[model samples]
Target: MLVLGIESSCDETGIALYCTRRGLLAHALHTQMAMHAEYGGVVPELASRDHIRRLVPLTQSCLKDAGADFADIDAVAYTQGPGLGGALLAGASYANALAFALDKPVLPLHHLEGHLLSPLLTDEGVDFPFVALLVSGGHTQFMAVHGVGDYVLLGETVDDAAGEAFDKTAKLLGLPYPGGAKLSELAELGTPDAYRFPRPMLHSGDLNMSFSGLKTAVLTAVEKARAEHGGSLPESVRNDICRAFQDAVADVLAAKAAAALRQTGLRTLVVAGGVGANRQLRQRLCALTIGKEAVQTFFPPPALCTDNGAMMAFAGAMRLRHGVQAAAPAGAFTVRPRWPLAQLSP
Candidate 1:
């Protein structure tokens, strides 16, 4: 079966083609980061417009790279939501229109599910019944995965997500837009223990987390440093703060992941979403030993770590392989701005 996936849940427009027998044939992505950078954040209107401009060309690019024709695509899959409504609509409309044109069935997939299942695209040896730590710009949660469409909510953030905190904290430290990656890079130059940020809810006796307070703590520290440094923070001081912040987040996530594994009695841990690409987090997880057994962690490739269509394509193919049928022909389609991953059933 061949599934063409379209992702426009947010600022990125991703298109891909996946063949069940051949794995991912090809994928193309166009991030609106540079455009949104000027605004210090994404503007929904701009994002939606960019998706309109990129989707068709990107899909064509994917087909060209795969050496496949539109007739070869058997199904069309798109992110059904948990994102900007306008952006979601762009992808949904395009996907449904394409499916209708090709007389192919449409599959409305949950965006988070796409991210959760992405690691499987590369690690073919990974089986079901694993623990998943999904941390991204808008979501931070732990889930127990029994199989495709079978996910149980383990825990989630009670406040700001880890990625949100990273971006907000970076902004507070005078970093540019899309600050999370820059913050992480600066952290590498920081001296160990020069600064130590709070690890919020690291021991609340549950899987739920809190990072909003951590961002406030960073603000407080930044204010103090500015006041002490005559209203200007030194470069070294900023780097140390970034390092402290990253360390705290890494420590909290790594500890919670280990706990989740122990609680579920699962040794295989899959990390997904943009924040899952954190080098420090990956390193910490790789070193984790749950109880006496070492934990095995899996992550999608760097390109797949962020929002992309290939995950949706691969996930759709998996569902099809599991006997889940695509949507019947319809006159109109809608997208979900907020949908729970647990709502999907096997």
Candidate 2:
């Protein structure tokens, strides 16, 4: 079966074709990060409008890349919930309309589920009952997974997500918006012990985490350095602060992840979402799990770690193979801005 996926949940417009027998055939994406950078964040209205303009063309390009045509598509999958209403609608409307015209089924996918399942698309060793750590711009969550669609929330951030913390802290340092990756790059040049930031709730003894306070702590550090220096904080000092901040986040995440693994007794750890792209976090996670204790660590290639349509297509294909019904014809449906992924089934 062939599934064409559409994703416009945020500032990216992604389209892809996933063939059950052949794997991912084609995928196209346009990130609005640079466009929204001037404003320091995503503009929902602008994001939605851009999706409207890009969806059709992107689908066409994906089809061409796959060497397939609309007639070859068996089903259409689109991100349907847990996103900005307007943005979701853009993809939803297009997917539904196309499915109706093609006389094909529509698959309404949960965005987070796509992220959770992403690691499986490439990693051959991943299996059921993995511990999931999804760290994105908008979400930081841990789940206990037992096979496809069987997800139980283990713990999550109570405030800002890890990616958000990175960006916010970077912003405070005069870095560009959407600065998470940039912040991480700078941290690589910094001395690991030059500064120390708290690892919040590291020993709280529960899965729940708090990162907003961690961000505030970074702000406090920046302020103290500026005040003490009488004008500007040195570049090395800023890099040190970045290093300390990244360390705090990586430590908290790594510690919590190990805890989740111990608590669930799951041997597989799959990291997804944007923040999963962090080199230090990857190093820490690998250091903790790799080549020891039967624990397997899997991460998508950096590009796939972020939001995209390929994961949606792959997830939809998984559902189709498992006998889940395709989405209803699109014009009659609505996006669930806050759907709980655990509510889905395989």
Candidate 3:
């Protein structure tokens, strides 16, 4: 079976074809990151408009890349929600319209499910039941995934995702918009002990984290540094602060991930979402995976770390290969912009 996946939940419009017999055949993506960068964040209306414009061309490109025609797709899968409503609608409408025209089944997939299942695309050897740390621009959470659609909520952020903190802090420090990656790069040139930032809820005895306070702490530190440095934060000082902030986040996540792994007694840890792209976080995770102990960690390739259609398509293939079918058709569809992964039926 072959599934064509469509994703337009936010700044990216992605289309892909996943073949059950062969894995990912081809994928195409159109990122509006540069457009949203100018605004320091995404504008939902503009995102929706761009998806509408890119969906068809991207789908065509994906099919052409696969050397397949539209008639070859056995099903159409699309991100159903847990994102901007208009953006979701753009993908949903396009997917449904195409499915209706093609007489193919439509799989309305959960976006987090897409992220959670993305690891399977990389590690074909990975099995069910593992700890998942999904850190993205909009979400930060720990989950215990047992199998397809079998996810248990371990913990999540009370406020401000890790990526959001990175971007906001970078902006305050006069870095470019969409500053998460840039901030991480600057952090590499900084000395670790030059500054220190707080680790929020490191000892709360649960999985829930709070990053909003950390960003405020950074703001306070930035203010003090500017005042002390003749009204402006110096380059070295800014880099040091960025390093400190990055370390703080990495420290808390590593601690929480260790706890999650221990609590579940699961040796495998899967990290997903945009923040999973941070080199510092990857370095920290790499260190943890080096021991002779029974723990291993996995992260998607940098491109797959963000929201994309390929994950959705790949996830749909998993569901189909495992005979996991959606209960409703296009006529009976519903979008859950705030759906919880633990609420999904396995």
Q: How should the candidates be ordered by TM-score, best one leading?
A: 1, 2, 3
- Give one digit per residue, the lDDT tens place, for model 2 in 119-223: 988887888878999999999999998877778999999999999999999999999988888999999999978888888899999998889987788889899
The Cα local distance difference test for each model comes to 0.92, 0.89, 0.88
Candidate 1: misplaced stretches above 4 Å? 325-327
Top model by TM-score, which number?
1
Clashing residue pair totals per candidate (backbone < 3 A): 0, 1, 0
Relative to the unseen true structure, what is the Cα RMSD of model 1?
0.9
Native-referenced Cα lDDT, model 1: 0.92
- Candidate 3 achieves a global lDDT of 0.88
Per-residue CA lDDT of model 1 for 188-251, tens digit only, reads 9998789887888899989999899888888999999999999999999999999999999999
- Candidate 1 lands at a TM-score of 0.98
Better of 1 and 2 by lDDT: 1
The alpha-carbon RMSD values of the candidates against the true structure, listed in the order shown, are 0.9, 1.5, 1.5
User: How many backbone collisions does model 3 have?
Assistant: 0
Rank by lDDT (best first): 1, 2, 3
lDDT of 1 at 64: 94
